[model samples]
Target: MIEDRYSTASTLYPYCRVSDQDAEPRRHPVVIVGAGPVGLALALDLGQRGTPTLVLDDHEGPGAGSKAICFAKRTLDIAHRLGAAKKMVEKGVVWNVGRVFYGGEQLFEFNLLPESGHRHPAFINLQQPYFEQYLIECIRVEQSKGTPIEIRGRNQVTALTDKGDFVALEVDTPEGTYKIEAEFVVACDGARSPTRDMMGLSFDGRVFEDNFLIADVRMEAELPTERWFWFHPTFAPNVQSTLLHKQPDDIWRIDFQLGWDIDRDKELDPSRICSRVDALLSSQTGDVPDYELHWTSIYTFQCRRMQEFRKGRIFFAGDSAHQVSPFGARGANSGVQDAENLAWKLDLVLKGLAPSALLDSYSSERTFGADENILNSSRATDFMTPKSKAATIFRDAALDLARDHAFARTIINSGRLSVPCVYDGHAHFVQDALTNGPEVTRPGAPCPDAPVEGGFLLDNLKGNFTVLAIGFDCSKLKLIDGVAVDVLCIHKPSEYLQERYLGGGKSAVYLIRPDQHVVGRWPEFSEDKIRAALLTALGKEPI
Candidate 1:
């Protein structure tokens, strides 16, 4: 049945034959270590760009359980570019409203999608298994179109050695062991990363002693499609907090805060889990429904990242590069962004279109992203589990004030939630000559989505460097020597477009990267200025 959800062929690719008697090793353009969302996404991006990619996973099929349920808007946008967002959006539970409570008292409720010019919603709640299934489908479609993306299961990378020009990998499979070489290696192996350990890399950051119990239950229940978070609920007095989220197929995800001194084995007992779930359910509706326990796991909070995401020909993405507290759903969302940021750069480098320095920008840009996720996740964890007596006092006082005063509601931290990180101060961005534009659509930010002629602006810019001309003719703009540019002209701009791109009342030209990040913008289109910005974005020159 699991194989039915994700096609059997989708999960298993023919294992390559590697005899120890072979004279030379088989070489690949890119080898991705893990088949999780990040690795699969990277493979899809590269494959669509005509790069041959080989994905290796030890498991025989997609993962079990609803691991990462919350996918942010920016992540969906990336999926859209990869041609995988339709099924993800359709099968996922979309929730734009969230309510935070202190005990039985409601503090405040916030709306994430207050205004909408974008095609996707603020966030979607889909099980990680389903997410991976959709991505695998996308990969298979690309492969059908002659983009070589090989996904081999039951294959494990036992050893890795950087050879400067290429990385040598020893893979252990069911049949036997084999050796393969790749121009680049992307490690998406996850938190306990073997590749990271093989490289002798260390993650540096804070780890909270607090533990959390995540339970996924399937039952028919009448509940609003919204996120509900509680601080010090009455039913679970010993627990610090609780979170409730709805998913597809009448399944619900509930997270309970278990303090530092919890008994790991004893707490994970089925009877104990049932009791905990019943207690929370009774507290809400005074009755527990007949529910099936689909999955349960306990994990500690950690906010750590590698010093650098890249080392030689071996690159790290997803959980291999960074780990964060699940409070804000930053782990998977940030990982997807990492894959998007790196795939394009790698494609260019492999095609000899840019220098190797282009890869360094991936490190700089994604490290900036990882740092932001770490900071927000750490702050949420500290608020949830106060480290010191003063912190605990402040947290309690803030909750008490939240019940009475509207201003105090801002202090509550159930979770900050995930949003795209703007690479504002990074060296890759070029500012406008007049330095005037909407703050949300400034250079280095993910291009804000707006409705254009046929579809959303993001739809047109998929997998290509774009020149967005607003109130200006882009027909005369010449392409750079090594860069292919797709020119999108807005003959009549909408209010949202005008507000986002023409806020300064000037005709503007914007250079957008293949990843849909704005490289720079100018009041008037100049061939030389745009070319210089393109070079700067590729990490070759200063603008």
Candidate 2:
């Protein structure tokens, strides 16, 4: 038996537990293993949906390292949904353009605004420490709202036992061994997840054959106006290279490649590392200031994803599920997507509105996404950090080609960083049926943004299910009780979405899910079809 003072926002809620003499017994609804951004995001999502979740972490406090400086538009979208995007955007640096340089010459520059259609809030460069703090604050506010979100810092889960109906877990805190039971569990414990190991799931993937020195240092001198990336030649022969990015706090994140075969003990010496950085910077500028090194560590790139995201009632999110190279900010962004995808499904399942099969789709949809991001990120890393002699020569040749061809230059230089991943392959949605409705419409596709009387069409469609009315009269459709769907009459959409969705001059209607993903669309308004798709998704029987 063990005892601890579990306090609420106003006061700590007392929690007591008893363990079996020889074996473990069943504690909380969902016990999350890691307290990183992924874990914290899941906690906030679950908490807001009125689900009980316990987040546990081995770390004493929040991590204060400069890792994952890039945030994709999709991640920013998730943050907005979580009610923290505005604050994050205010605190972070908004970067729409980035520069890639080779041998003191500009290879190519890519701008995101044109590609993404507008100031996408697409990608921002920010400190990971501050972002984590923002999430912690959001969790605290939710806790204060009477939706209990238990965050156990300095507590580690030692063992887990699955007993069919529920899961039993043993956690070791400063006091002693403790046990808790929950209906489900989510393991976001990161790359070295003990929860994954305990569940006996295979993490099948590859660890690259090169090490990189990661450093966060305050810039000592005037920096370039753009987000600069460099591939330079050093005093050492044709060996490893560097990757650098300027962060929010006047700090620069620098990564120097150490050859794969170098000795770990000799390679990780901090003084030697700093000397190399100074040498590289000195060649670009006459003098550089002495920098205060915030953190230094030797990390190798790894491209590995878990075979499955769930082991019984225990689900995995973040690094526990998939890990990609930090190239193009895919690692953290994908993990945030995992939390967003899982949160709504988990909420629906708990509320008994959907079948358990919907939960299975979470892994299928996200794992497919993980594979895509991992493949793209791995290719980017390979291009950036070439190991073999033949590959290096090929990479250099490609860069030379990029310098000559305008389109080729953009292709090689533009970091194809965050494409909004589609869940089309997942079998949950009624895809084929909706595709046959209109020429411009497609089933299971993202709702096309159109011009309406409101701010943006999407802005007004928030909160509940929305049914857009096209050329057909909406008054003809019969209303159903307790069903929430908005009818927006669009006689002239061309006046609004110029050159976008309505450019083809066709009237269309759409049914949007609460999460803002399109469920179905049609050229004509049909009361039966809209209600049917809604009932199917919401698990309500047809009237």
Candidate 3:
């Protein structure tokens, strides 16, 4: 087993023998290989929908260190649907404003979320371990309610065979080995996924050469909660770029960009890391290094992914399917979105409500999402580390002008923060017959949250196909297959809701997917158009 290295997160799941060890190979509806945040979140999504899911992991609980700390609003929305966002939002340090600096001068600042109607904030700085812990706790809550979610700690998959209709899995435990079969298998094992390697699939993309050192120090600092980033700050002469974020429990995250080709071990020395931290503290606020070192590591960025996410009964999700630079916080957010996209489709297929072809959309849509993230990540990496002299000259010029010019500030690439992938113009979306609706709620886009009667609109779209009737009455008996489309009729929407959903119009209706994405929207509700749209969205009819 791999060591935790420098993590103090609690071991929420421990090894336990299951009856499958002794009995013949047991068959399950679904098997997820990995119990990290991505795996656990996928299991929770499936189990919450009453689908039987088994999750296996090599380790006992969350992995080492604060890996992905920036939880975007899109991620929180997905977590809220999976019943895992309450504690996370409560314990996290929420922020929306960010300041950027270049060469010891402030280069303006920006707010991620200026308008307010959503339930969650624009972003939150929470440790990765705490995020996984909250997801496990929510899974435990579901298990108590008889949700068919089971986690097998210390159970590692040794072999997997795609047998067309099912997947045969051989797992290793402390007690020895055992065999099992699953109708479908999802690999969320991580960037170096053994599952993808076993399948002999290639994860193709670019790996950036530059490296960055991360230090998580526990201290009561006077820094604001906003994200502060610098390009060639005066405090640290050796550092090329730096990033600072305030995490919960008085722990702060600091990253210093050390250009490629350095001694990894020597740079990780206690005194070396402390010197950098001390320099920043003393230069900024005239304070010494009065903080306890919590964790330290160095990492390079890789913008890579498999060509496709599905191969027969086995599918890939999260870091297993794709890997991106940490900038923009796209890695985990996109992974969670992969789970959200795959769960509803898998649920319908497992229940025989939709044709098996519906599963293909999971791969196509998420692959598109992965490509988008990789493109952005690659651009950010290129912008930060300009290869040619000409590119460096241009970047510096832009940074110089960004101090006073607004348009120049727009060109600054300080890791564009993560945002929801709008599946706009995708073929899967039914062409909206009802014209002149809000583009934010267009087909294939993530439906924007707004104030409603109870609390928020997203709270009502957790686990089923929905017909959100705004400022109108929609009593359509929804069906593309045998699945029933639930309807939420809002006869009188609040101004926020009307502006977001209706585009200031009086009446509109929307078809929403289980993952809170818009299937289609119309000015008025019609049974025929809605039914046709369901068929198109479900892959039963050609769009």
Candidate 4:
């Protein structure tokens, strides 16, 4: 049930008309705060699982502006699962090449598509608003399919209290204060997350000393083939540079570095913005082209990550959990992954299939991934924004080397730093007894997207636990009791994923959980081993 309430008491769910004087508890399975991508993604996943979710947000409509302009392959996969990927792919620009320029020449041009099989959309450049609108429509379709997802827009949560059994929320709607009670609450609010604040979690990390200006402007001058990056040292020392990205609606996103000497307040003026853009492009391109500025914002890059991603029954997703510079497009991709990581666990807990302890994996897995993203993005930031003289010298040396040598060029443009994150640790699946296998597509790694019998493998694994039996012998593994494991036999190396993953195998059998994490693997398939691994993953002892 979708409720776009300007100010109404009656709702699809159990609604009660009450003022601040006579409000009572209204319990739901889950209550989500903030209707951003992360929160709504969580809601969509929960609703698909028939878990009643109440999503509350202050804004009535989708967000404005083009904050995050990049999306990764993994995010595209998740979007495909939610049925929104097709829309995004059709509308957004597919960016497969990123060019790194130094001085006036192209220092290194990275073809990102060769490494990532053209199977996945490399990186997508799109305005955030349209991307979100597509998602909102998908959510509506999911609602029409009979999943009860209550969206209370223009209603901001004033306060939240964890009451052990359930969470109590005080929401300030247009009518008055309304109390909402739910078994769990997920906060996907932006950096200023009130839920995280209520948990008393401190976001502790480094704040970059420099700040930059982001502006969307109409351009007149012809630019290079919509390539993503431009690292020009032409304006070094003064720290003048620009990152130009193509946006929809004939606007270009321009990010420029303003040296510490410049005043941020002064840069807000249109003339100062024009001067900055002109300075960054004048020598290489030519005179300032005709342009109209649409929007401008001054922002300092922060690499701050939260102490924890979960607090009791409340969970934190998106910018609330961690924040990083937009160098490698880690911000939105990480948030989307956060939603994906959390959705399965929350579904299991809500459905009573797994104990609440299963929810603990969200913090372990997501925070680890967050730290890695921060490290990568920070490195990209450091390379992009060379602060000190020594740092600048190092960057120039690397770029010069790239220009001269093929090895150096490959080394510099590996872009392996931007690959999808692997869940190496804190997976809560690999146990001690089952840990004697070689490190070739082991547990905690993303199950290789293989093709089986004619279609993509994950397609068959839509709703069941899949047991990827890679090792040859499978006759003895037929009688696992009370546990379900779909068997897939991989005899030789797959032509599709030969170089990317460990494909040549006969002894490896992966017990894949429904959430798609490798729960267990054995050299030889055995009914007993499979049962124990599933029990352990679900936090249930074999009976």
Winning model by lDDT: 3
Assess each prediction's global lDDT (C-alpha) against the native: 0.86, 0.69, 0.88, 0.70
When superposed on Cα atoms, how far off is each prediction in RMSD? Answer: 3.1, 5.0, 1.7, 4.9
Q: What C-alpha lDDT does candidate 4 achieve relative to the native structure?
A: 0.70
Q: Estimate each model's TM-score.
A: 0.95, 0.85, 0.97, 0.86
What is candidate 4's lDDT per residue for 145-236, written digit by digit as tens?
88888787667787899899999888876567768788999999877787777667898888777778898887755765466455564644
Q: Write the per-residue lDDT of candidate 2 for residues 78-144, one digit (tens) a residue.
A: 6666776777888787766677767667777766563333224667888766677788888878878
Model 1 / residue 524 / CA error / Å: 0.6
Ranked candidates, highest lDDT first: 3, 1, 4, 2
Name model 2 segments beyond 4 Å from true: 1-27, 114-120, 232-239, 387-390, 410-415, 432-442, 445-505, 535-543
> Backbone collision count in every prediction?
0, 9, 0, 2
